[model samples]
Target chain A: MKVAILGMGSVGKGVASVLSSKDLGVMVTGVADSRSGLIDPDGINIGALLATKRSTGLCGSAGITAMDVVRGAPYDILIEVTPTDAVSGEPALTHIRTALTMGRHVVTSNKGPIVHALHALRSLAASKGTSIRYEATVAGAIPIMHTLADGLAGNEVLALYGVLNGTCNYILTRMAAEGLTYEQALLEAREMGYAEADPTYDVKGIDAAIKLVILANTIWGTSSCLKDVEVRGIDLVTLDALQLAEDQGCTIRLIAEADPSNRILRVSPRILRSRHPLVTEGTLNAITLVTDLAGEITLMGKGAGSVETASAIIGDLLAIRSRYGRCD
Target chain B: MKLEMRDAPGQLVAALKPISDLGGNIIAVIHQRDPGSRSEVLGVQIVLDLPQDRLSDLTDLIRSQGVNILRVNEERLLCTRAVIMIGHLIHTDLGGTVDAIDRTGFAEVTGLTIRMPAIDQRSSARFTIRSVNREHMEDAIAILRTVAREKGLLMIEPMGVSQ
Candidate 1:
C-alpha cells in the first residue's frame, strides 16, 4: 500500500523508519514537514529522506506544501501524524477532509481532528466509500480503539477510566515515590524530556480531556467535546495530599473518565488504591473499560513516544489494507 | 413514623422529643405546612433509626405525649464513600461544608480527619460520607462537588471499578 505521510515530526519519522526497515508491504509515496513537501509517483526513498531530514530538516522543496501532497499526491492513504492543535483541528482537518472527499483512506495519529470533527469526518469517509481509521489518536500503542471497535464489539460499555497523560503521570509518580514537591517533580520531568517547555496542555488535564472526548465519541457516539469534560489538573496536587493518600495504602493519579449513563465526563486527579489497575507508574498509560458482558477490561502500554505512536498508525494502515485489499 | 397532632403550638415539638429521649438518630423530618388552611390536625412523617429493642418503647413514649401514630416506615443507610478534600478548610467554613450534606438528612459526614501542614499552606481532610443508598450517595456527591467548587477546594473522590 502506498501512503503520503504529513508533518515529518517524530511520529512521521518513526513511521518512515519502520516502513523502510521492514518488509511490511507498505510504501511511502509522499512526505512533508512543516516547511517542505516531497512527492514521487514511483514511491519516495524513505531511508534517504529520513537521513536528509536528520541533517537538513527539509524533506522536499519549500515551493511544494502539505496540501500539495494531500491533494495532488498519487497515493492510496494519507497518513496524518501532525502535532495536535487541540482547538481548531486545523490544517490537519483540511488535509483529512480533502483526502476523504477524494475517496482515499486516512490513518491519523492526530487527536485534534478526531476530537473536534469526528462525526463529520466519518460521514465524509462513508459518503466517499473509504475508511478513516484513527487507532493512534488515543492511548499510544495501546490498541484501545481497535479493541473497542472489534474485540468488544457486542458488549455494552458502562464506564471508562484512564490515565491518559504521560507527563502528569510521570510528575505524579516522581512526587509520590521520592516525596518531591510538584515543582520539583515537574522540573525533573522537563529535564528528562517527558514534559514540554509549556507543559500546561498536559499538566492542566487538557490533553487527557481531548483523549477522553475521542474515546467517548468513538465508543458511544456521545458527541462530546473538550469543554464537556469537567477538567481539573494535577497542578494543585501537593506532597501532603500524597502522604495522606499513602497513609491509607492509596495513591493519586490524573484520571480521565466517562460514565455516559451517569452523565459524567470528567478529567481530574483522583485517589485510587495502590493496587488498582489504573495506578500505572511513570509515563505509562492505562485504561479500564467497564463492560456488561466482559465485566471489566484493562489495557496498559506506552502512552506517547515516536515509535510507540507509529505502531498505532502502522496498525491502522494494515487494518485498512486487509479490509480493502492492497493499494498498488 | 407518621404522626397526627393538633395544629396547636409545641405539639410537633412534643411529638419529636421522644425520639431524642429514646436515643434514636433522626434522619429526616418531612412535613408540609399550609397556613391558609384552617385544619384542626397536622400530619408529619419522621424517618429515624434506633435499636430494634427500643422501637416499642419509643412508640409508646410518642403516644404518651398525645400524638397519634399514623404510619411507620423504616430505612437504613447502606453506602459509605470517603473523599479527600484539599484547600483552606477553616477559611471556607468547614462546618458549613459538612452541614450542606448533613442538612439533607439522607446523608451525613460520619467521619473526618484533617491534616494541617502549616498555618497558611493548604489543609487536607478525608470525609467519610454515608447515605441511605447508592442513589442518595450520588446526590450527596453532587452536592459536595458544588460545595467544593464554591469553596475553591480540590475534592479527590474515590474511583470505583465501575465508576
Candidate 2:
C-alpha cells in the first residue's frame, strides 16, 4: 500500500522509519511536515527524508505545503499524525476529510478530529467506500479499538475503565512508589520527558477525557465530546490524600471510565488497590474492557512513544491493506 | 453436541455407543459431573467427526437412549498453522497477545508451548492457531504480526502448509 504521512514529528518520523526499516509491503509516496512537503509517485526515499529533517528541521524543499500533499499527492492511505487541538480540531480534520472524501483510507493519531466530528467523518468515509482508523488516539499500542471492533465482535461492551493518560499515571506512580509530593512528582515527570512543558492537558485530565470521548464513541456509538466527560485532574490530589489512600492499601490513579449502559463518562483520580491491573508504573497505559463474551479483559502497554504510537498506525495501515488491498 | 444425561452407572458409555454405531468418530468428550447440583444429570460435550448423512441417525439413536441433547454447533475451525515467536514473551504479556487472537471468533490459538532458559533471557513459544478458513488464518497471522511488532518480538510463521 502507498501511504502519505502528514506532520513529520516524532510519531511521523517513527512511522517513516518503520516503513523504511521493515518490509511490511508498504511504501511512503508522500510526506509533509508543518513547513514543507515532498511527493514522489514511485516512492520517497525515507532514509534521505529523515536525514533532511535532522539537518534542516524541515521535510522537503520550498513552495511545498501540506495542502499540496493532501490535494495532489499520489497515495492510497493518508496517515495524519499531527498534534491535536482539542478545541478546534482543525487542519487535521480537514486533511482527514479530504482523504476520506477522495476515496483514500485514513489512519490518524489526532484525537481532535475524532472527538469533534466522528459521525460526520465516518459517514463521509462510508459514503466514499473508505475507512478511518485511529487506534493510536486512545491508548497507544493497546489495540483497544481493534479489540472492540473485531476481537470482541458479537459482544456488548458493558463498560470501559482505563489508565488513559501516561503523564498523570507516571506522576501518581512516583508519588505512590517513592512517596513524593504531587509537585515533586510532576517535576520528575517533566524532567523525564513524560509530561509536557505546559502539562495542562496531561495534568488537568483533559487528555484522558478526550480519550474517553473517543472510546465511548468508538465502542458504544455515543456522540460524546470533551465537554460531555466529567473531568477532574490530579493537580489537587495532595500528598495527604495519597498517604490516606496508601494507608487504606490503595494508590491514587487517574482513571478514565465509560459506562455506556448508564450514560456515564468521567476521568478522575480514583483510589485503586496497589496491585490493581490498571495501576501500572512509568509511562504505560492500561485498559480494562468489560464485555459480555470476553468478560473483563485488560490490556497494558506503552502509552506514548514514537515507535509505540507508530505501531498502532502501522496496525491500522495493515488492517486497511488486509481489508482492501492497494486501492490504487 | 452438548447433551445432558442421567448420572448413573453406564451413562457415559451409553452416550458414546450411538455415535460409534452410526460410523461417527469421537474427537473429544468433555464430561462435567456436578456433584453439588440438585439434579442428577451430567453435562457431556462430545466433538464428533462424521458424514452429514449419519448425523440424523446418530441424533436419533442418542435420543432413543434417553439422552437429552442441549445444543449442537458446527466446528468452524478447519485451517491451522503453527508459528514460533521469540523474545521477552512473558514480560510482554503473552497471554494478552494470545487472547487478542483467540477472542476473535474466526480464529483461535488451539495449542501453545513455551521455552525459557533464564529469568532475564529471551523466551519462545510455538503456537498452533486454527481458523475458520484460509482467509481467517491469514487475518489471524496479520494480527499476530501486529502484536509482535508492538511487543518487540520475532515471529517465524509457517510457510505454505497447514496443520
Candidate 3:
C-alpha cells in the first residue's frame, strides 16, 4: 500500500515509521511539509528518516510542500500530520481537502480540520467516493472515534465528555495528587515535555474545547463549532480552588464535554465527584459516551504521543486497506 | 485593585453591599454563567472603573467582604484584530491557546469557530482576536505560532505566512 505523510513533525514522522513496518503492508511513498518534501513513489526510506531525526532534532532531508504530495502519484492513504493553529488549520485543511478531492483516503491527527471542517470535508469525501478516517483525533490511540462510529453505531450518543488534553490533564492531575500549585504543576509539565513551552492552551482549556467540538459533532450530526460552545480554562484553577473542590468530594479534571440534548459543548476545569467510571484522572484521556441503548460507554488511555497516535493511524489505514484497497 | 468574588448564593450582592457601603460605585460588574458546567461556579470578569482617588478604598472594601480579587491591573481592550488558525485546533486547547494570547495583556481570542470531522484529524478554526495595541497583534500571532507547534497544529495566520 502506498502512503504519504503531509507533515514531517513528530506525529508525521511517527506515522511514516509505523507504516514502514513490514507487517503493516504499507510503503511510505513521500513525506511533505510546508517546505518541500522528499518523495520516492517507489517508497522512501523511513528508517533513514527516523535515525536522522533521533540523532539530530531537525529534519535536514529533502522535503515537499503539501501540494506536491497531494499532486504526486496517488497513494492508498495520506497521513495529514501538519501542526494545528487555534484559528486556521490551513495547510492541513488544504492537504486533506485536496487529497479527498483527488480520491485518496485520508487519516490525520490534525485536530484543526476535524474540529472546524468535518462536515464540509465529509461531504467532499462522499462526493469523491473516498473515505476520511481519523481515529487518532480524539483520545489519541483509544479508538473513541471508531467506537462511536462503528462499535456503538447502533447507539445514539447523548453526550460525550472526557479529559481530552493530556497536557492539561497532566497538569491538573499533578496539582490534585501531589498538591502542587497550578503554576508549579504547569512548570513541571513543561519541563517534562508534557506541556508546550507556551502552555497557554493546555492551562486555559481551549485545547479541550476543540476536542469537544469534534466529539459533539461526531456523535450528533451538527457543526458544533468552537464559537457555539462555552469555554472556561484551568488558568483560574488556583490551589485553593482545587483544594476547595476536593473538599467537596471532587477532583479537578480538565474536561471537554458536549450535551447532545442541548446541542451545546463546553471545555473547562471540572470538579468531578460523581463516583462515575470516568472520574479518575491523570495523564489519561477518558471519555463517557452516553447513549440511549448502551447507556454509557467509557474509554480511557494514553491520549497523545508519536507511537500511540501513529499506531492508531496505522490501524485505521490497515482496516481501510482490508476493506477498500483491492477496489481502488 | 479588584477582586473576584465567588458567584455563590448572595455572593455578588454581598460583595456589592460592602463596596457600596464603603462608598464604592461598583463601577462595572461583569458576570456570566460558566459555559462548561452549570453546577460549577459562575465566572465573572468584572472591571471596576473606580475613580483613581477612590481606588484604594474600593479595593480594601471589596477585600473585606471576602471576595477574592482574581486580577487587578490596568483597563484596556482597544484595537482588536482577527486571526484564523488551522489544525488539531480543539485538541490543542483553543481556549488555552486564546488565553495564552490574552496573557500578553494586549490581545485575546474574542470569538472562535471550529469544525471537526472526528477525534483524530486536523481541525480548523477561525478566531476573532482583539488586542489593546496594534503591534500587540503581532506578538499574539507569534505566541499562537508557538502554541500551534506544540499542539501538532498548522496555524493559518490571517497575514498568510506561506508554509
- The lDDT per prediction is 0.90, 0.86, 0.72
> How does chain A of every candidate compare to the true chain A by TM-score?
0.99, 0.98, 0.93
Cα lDDT tens digits, model 3, B1-163, are 3445565788777666755665544457777666676554455655543434666676677677777777678655555544445466666666788789767766778877665546875554556677755567767877886886687554433321110
Q: Compose the digit string of candidate 1's lDDT tens values, residues A193-282.
A: 999999999999999999999999988987889889999999988888888788888999999999988788999998899999999999
TM per candidate: 0.83, 0.67, 0.64
Candidate 1 chain B, run of 10 with poorest lDDT: B72-81
DockQ of each: 0.42, 0.01, 0.01
Model 2 per-residue lDDT tens digits across residues A1-328: 7999999999999999999999998888889988889999999999999999999999996689887898898889999999998999989999999988899999999999999999999999999999999999988989988988888899998888899999999998888788897799999998998988899999999999999999988887779888889777877665555655565466678888888765668786665667788889888899998888889899999999999999999999999988986666
Q: lDDT tens digits, residues A1-328, model 3? A: 8888887777887787676675666777777666556668677777886776567653434454568768884577888888886589777888899889898889988889898799999999999988888788877889987787679978877777687888887877788788897789989988888988788877777788888887777777787687887676776555544554455465566667677565446675554663646665667888887788998778888888888998788878877887685533
What lDDT is obtained when candidate 1 is compared to the true structure?
0.90
Evaluate residue B57 in candidate 1 and report its C-alpha lDDT on the 0 to 100 scale.
Answer: 94
Query: Which candidate's TM-score is highest?
Result: 1
Better of 1 and 2 by lDDT: 1
Selected candidate, larger TM-score, 1 vs 2: 1
